[model samples]
Target: MTTRDALQTQLEQGIAALGLHLPADAVPRLLDYQALLERWNAAYNLTAVRDPAEMVTRHLLDSLAILPYVQGRTLADLGTGPGLPGIVLAIAAPGREILLVDSNGKKVRFLREAIRALKLDGVRAVQSRVEDVEGQYDCVTARAFASLADMLGWGGHLLAPDGIWLAMKGKRPDDELAGIPAGFGLRGTHELAVPGLSAERHLLVLGHA
Candidate 1:
């Protein structure tokens, strides 16, 4: 039963049906980052879902269903193409400090070869373009990229000052939450049930109004 033991038995029954209490080496480093993103999506198509059991329900349980609203100590995924949920929340929260950001270039060269083959540490990819990325960041993720007022008008100075911007999305946009843009607000909108995914997921959760 090896294909990383059938994707670690479908990521341990979808993290025990999303009660989620990860880190028993986070399901073998999320099945070794889904076998290095399905061996670099067979030469950099990065992701079109390409079945590794639909990359475990559309890329690792739709990127760990926002892993319990990820807080603090640096994050910053912004258009992180291949590294959804910023390399699956830096492989299930290995003490924060993620920073993926992407401008393409073969999906930032497969996110720096899956953060150097998942040794992962604090993690870091950066090809730039999230409005020329710089610093600040207690948290800030993005997934269907633009349109939360153009993703907080392009990375909203990389979040900090009580950060938090999560955003992955699918349905419930409500006109991108009424075009949020006066500093920012709407700190709630969750609705994810990924497990084997039925589609129509959401996350939203913004901050700093």
Candidate 2:
């Protein structure tokens, strides 16, 4: 059928493969967000993954895979370029105040438009470096933003005590594991499965040491 239909099927199957259920409107909203990003990408070059089908696997499903570990009522998605997991998470599961942080002006502008166009409540986007942004969140997320040590070092203060940090990375970051800075301990590492994706994907969970 059409390309959009194909992407829709891929997203649906991917969600099921992850053994997660989403609200009826969730899927449509997700596709809408993708469309919006795609339009903006034409002008801003928001993300490297330009293919719609690839976006389904690399962007949408990859983000959805971490849904189980996204705890706490407030979450800060640092270096959330074009709002990868942040926007994806906000759509997949409603509620939980989400802050999408990025240093890029174009990306943040795109993020705001996406938030409003999607009619997403409790979600906001800000243009600021991860380190400059203030306030604590019950959960913090970084998608390969920086080294384990550097990411925690810059944004570690944002994570509330007993909060969880979900660092999304490809393959197990064995080398960077040792660099996890002081006061932050590795909670665990989880392998994520995204349908139609065979490449390695891992999520490093961290908390107070």
Candidate 2 lDDT by residue in tens digits, 1-209: 88788888989989999999998998889999998988889899999999988898999999999999999999999999999899999998899899999999999999999998999899999998888989999999999899999999999999999899999999899999889998999999999888888999999999988
TM-score computed on alpha carbons, candidate 2: 0.98
Q: Please, what is the TM-score per model?
A: 0.34, 0.98
Give each model's whole-structure lDDT.
Answer: 0.85, 0.93
lDDT of 2: 0.93
Residue 159 of candidate 1: its Cα lDDT?
A: 92
| Model 1 whole-model lDDT (C-alpha atoms) | 0.85
Candidate 2 residue 85 Cα shift, in angstroms, is 0.2
* Tens-place lDDT digits, model 1, residues 1-209: 86678878988899889888877787888888888888878977888878788888888888887888988988888888888888887888788778888888898888888888888888888787998889989889898888899989888888988888988888979887878888889978888988887879988888888
- Can you give the lDDT of residue 173 in candidate 2? 93
